[model samples]
Target: MLNRNNLYFIRRKVTNHIMLSLTFLSVVLTVLPLLLIFYYTVTKGLTSLNLDFFIAMPKPVGEAGGGMANAIVGTLILIGIGGAIGLPVGIMSGTYLAEFGNNKFGNVVRFLADVLSGIPSIVVGVVAYTIVVLPMHHFSAFAGGVSLAILMIPTITRTTEEMIRLVPHSYREAGLALGIPKWKTSLVIILRSAWKGIATGVLLAFARAAGETAPLLFTALGNRFWSTKIFQPIASLTVYIYDYAKSPFTEWNDQAWTASLILIALISLISLLFKFLTRSKY
Candidate 1:
């Protein structure tokens, strides 16, 4: 008995309600896993947290009260080296792809990036082993950084390309109209306009690299003692966690939990810092 307009309105409302419910469900699915990970990590890891965990070296097996200070420092060094290698290369490569991507060579580069992005992390580790580790005659932090940088490149390149492409073409024209060179306009106006998004990509690449362990295994090789040399084996949070979690020692297991917490905290802090940086400019 309803009029056609009334029927159409009712059907539209029902469709919208259904769509809204689905969207909410998808959001919950995405968020619930993250929330669970945070809860589990915090609860289990808090019991083992202590000052020595940050300042002191790991005690000899069967000893208690050692910290992951060396591991923490080693991670920082690896990330720094990797970032230095990857960030600029990724940015430049991405700019090229975005600006000059409508060509055969660009298609090849895009194909390569896509392939690398899908490659396994362990496969990258093996490749690094064959190349960097073998040439050096031993595992080293330098090789580990190289491996991580390789993993980061495709991702950063893609993200940077996408972010740069998102900048309005009008900006480019405006800069050109002002007598700016194409390269200068791209760097000064276009890049500045999209800086926040590009930074987010860099941070994301950093985070992804930080979480890898297999690549380090074939390269850094895990040092138990403090080693500042880039060519020397070094500890990282993920590698340290791997070693500790496998040990029969209850104390080592507890320390592993603490290390897990610390790694999570460090990554979270980095993410928050970048988030603030992005928002501050906007």
Candidate 2:
């Protein structure tokens, strides 16, 4: 039998070991599901991934061996337009909130942005449908882009505001002390300092917009063939995944898995890029 002092020391050692084991177990549990998802996606999607899947147009129903080249291209186009619209507007709003947000109107603007961010994306799609699709009397890529940009605006706004606020007020004062205009100081000193963080926000918004399907359904309306005109219908990866996954055909089903893999990869890449950019010494 050990002395009481030795017993106490053993108890502390055992407790520490147990706590460490629990921490490692928790990590494993968290990572297990992600590992399973990646394994399944790779196993199922690899067979369907081919050169033709990137180069060829989507085939009609009852056909075999087709690709989502149009959807790929359209997805890029919609995101491009959405980012263009959201980036400047979001940056401006964020700058306003950060610099002039002590007032009641600024509070109202921030509240509105929070409300907009929380609104369901499907609801934004409906609003865009009413404003753009109905007015144009057609389902067009422009409407889809508008819907995505609406979804992106709030996130970008909040992120930009947060990043700009992190810039030391001393930097602002220094520029102003040099007799620079407030606007010029904001643009040159504050915004430039926070550009990397803003870029992360923009990339995150782009990834989110790329994955949306509901907004595009009633807006872009899913083109089967290649279409470059923003005024015309367009294909999108999310819509294609939705349409193909529910089909009875085995090939389309496989393609859906591949599309899912692509989407997952794209999102992960964006997140990784954000992590890298934030870690960099700008």
Query: Which residues of candidate 1, in runs, are more than 4 Å off?
Result: 1-26
Write out the backbone clash pairs for model 1. Answer: none
Model 1 agreement with the true structure over 1-99: per-residue lDDT tens digits: 999999999999999999999999999999999999889888989877988889998899877688989999999899988998999899889888988
The C-alpha lDDT values of all candidates are 0.91, 0.90
Number of backbone-clashing residue pairs for each candidate, in the order shown: 0, 0
Candidate 1: worst 10 consecutive residues by lDDT? 273-282
Instruction: Give the lDDT of residue 264 in candidate 1.
Output: 85
Local accuracy of candidate 2 as per-residue lDDT tens digits, 33-112: 99999998889988789988888898877888889889888988898888889989999999989987879998998899
| Residue 32 in candidate 1, Cα distance off native in Å | 2.6
What's the lDDT for candidate 1?
Answer: 0.91
Give stretches of model 2 more than 4 Å off: 1-18, 268-282
User: Residue 40 deviation, candidate 2, in Å?
Assistant: 1.9
